[model samples]
Target: MSHLPAVTLNNGVAIPQVGFGVFQIPDAETQATVSTALEIGYRSIDTAAVYGNETGVGRAVAASGLLRDELFVTTKLWITDLGRTSARDALHASLDRLALDRVDLYLIHWPAPATDAYLEAWQGLEELYAEGLTRAIGVSNFLPEHLDRVVALGGTVPAVNQIELHPALRNRETAAAGAAHGVATEAWSPLAQGGALLAEAPVVAAARAHGVTPAQVVLRWHLQQGHIVIPKSATPSRIAANLDVFGFELTAAESAAIDALDRDGRIGPHPATFHG
Candidate 1:
């Protein structure tokens, strides 16, 4: 293949390796950002009901004139919608908002392990998966303890587990658990916010050698490690750069050089501590 290769999920679903993520994208800007992304060869579009941009995302994707089957759209259920009935309703509502028959993948926005309802909520996910409302079901920000409960409830092994992953905070232990359980790890923040990683001597050298931007080198590192990454950008230039990671390969040493940057730096909220 000339570009990034999709990884087969536990259920044999082929998820695009490099997808566009719309986490902090505002509802007003989603259409333009997504339209730009689709025009740049991005087939996978990731959004969440919690992101409040689902409607805009759907609008842009629908307006793109791409066949629904040709595009892979993924969304998540908010923690508030964690009950069986609520989760099921959330699935349909998400579909309606996204203007799709069924999402390629659906995920629980967060485990919210503190609640008494996660196990109760899982049944809803299972039901939706069975009904094909969601092509696959998974959880995000779930730790090993949470995964144990999910398995104990006789829940379907998640096809994917979206988590905060970057050069820092690699989540090595969690990655092993996911692999042992046949769940794939998807990186939400593959690029750290700080310019530090891109400015590092090693990364700069690698980018120079490949004649690409530092961001491409960082994304290239994520790919070589067998991690699925969704790096987001609204600017046309960065959006195009994020998608141009297919042509080059990173050497083992180059990959390791980036790996050395891992210091367990976590920039986002810890799911365990998040109140919502």
Candidate 2:
């Protein structure tokens, strides 16, 4: 089995540096695909209430026969569930679908500044954390200002801040802001939704130099920069290939070259304006 490295979060909980994501993965295909990933050595599985595949993820994990402690599962609360009571109820609903007693990490899916209740939602996460329903809690797609609000509201500092990150859309500012508060940055669209950054000249050059795929090169860049990355793939070969990045290293020049590819090209919805 491949030994994936782990990064300790602010709360002293360790998370696998590389995780498997199931975004937009059809519900019907989720079980088999996630089971294949587990068979390929992916211990961390990320899903969300919005994904509509939490039950599939639950089924795969249960069927994997891996010890509950051996796997790290994460899920998120949706926008509609954005207050203390509703957030707690939403978490219970998600847990029912996941069929797990407790998720390793539960995150607030979005700040939804328009609703202006993320702080209240965050307090609900705090209650979950205190109640031991989740080991750790964090937020996703939160900008610096949102984090600042958390700081002002006085709650547990988020252990992770998941955001859309890739070479072409390096969110250094948000990552740095999270880092300032000891929140580990986790990349959601780590491969730029798979293939856009893989074709970039710098990424291609690094891949050739490393004798690996461009996707591997980009994942290595994220790891080298100390960010947690989850690259999603339903294809068996590509799933295995994505985790094969541990064998090589990216040089400083090569890393910088890929960094230079940043053009503020964000491929996902902007957190500032995305209400859903």
Q: 1-276 in candidate 2: lDDT tens per residue? A: 127899899999999999999999988899999999999999999999999999999999999999998999999999999999999999999999999999999999999998679999999999999999999999999999999899788779999999999888899899999989999999998988646778999999989998999999999999999999889998999999998888999999999999999989898899999998
Global lDDT of each model?
Answer: 0.87, 0.93
**What is the alpha-carbon lDDT for the whole of candidate 2?**
0.93
Error of 1 at 182 (Å): 0.7
Candidate 2: clashing pairs of residues = none
TM-score for each predicted model, relative to the true structure: 0.96, 0.98
Clashes of each: 0, 0
Q: How far off is residue 82 in model 1, in Å? A: 1.5
- Which pairs of residues have clashing backbones in candidate 1? none
Task: Determine which window of 10 residues in candidate 2 has minimal summed lDDT.
Answer: 189-198
| Predicted candidate 1 versus true structure: per-residue lDDT over 108-176, tens digit per residue | 888887785777778889998998888888888888778778878865988888999888778888888
Worst 10 residues of 1 by lDDT: 1-10
After best superposition, candidate 1 residue 214: deviation in angstroms? 1.1
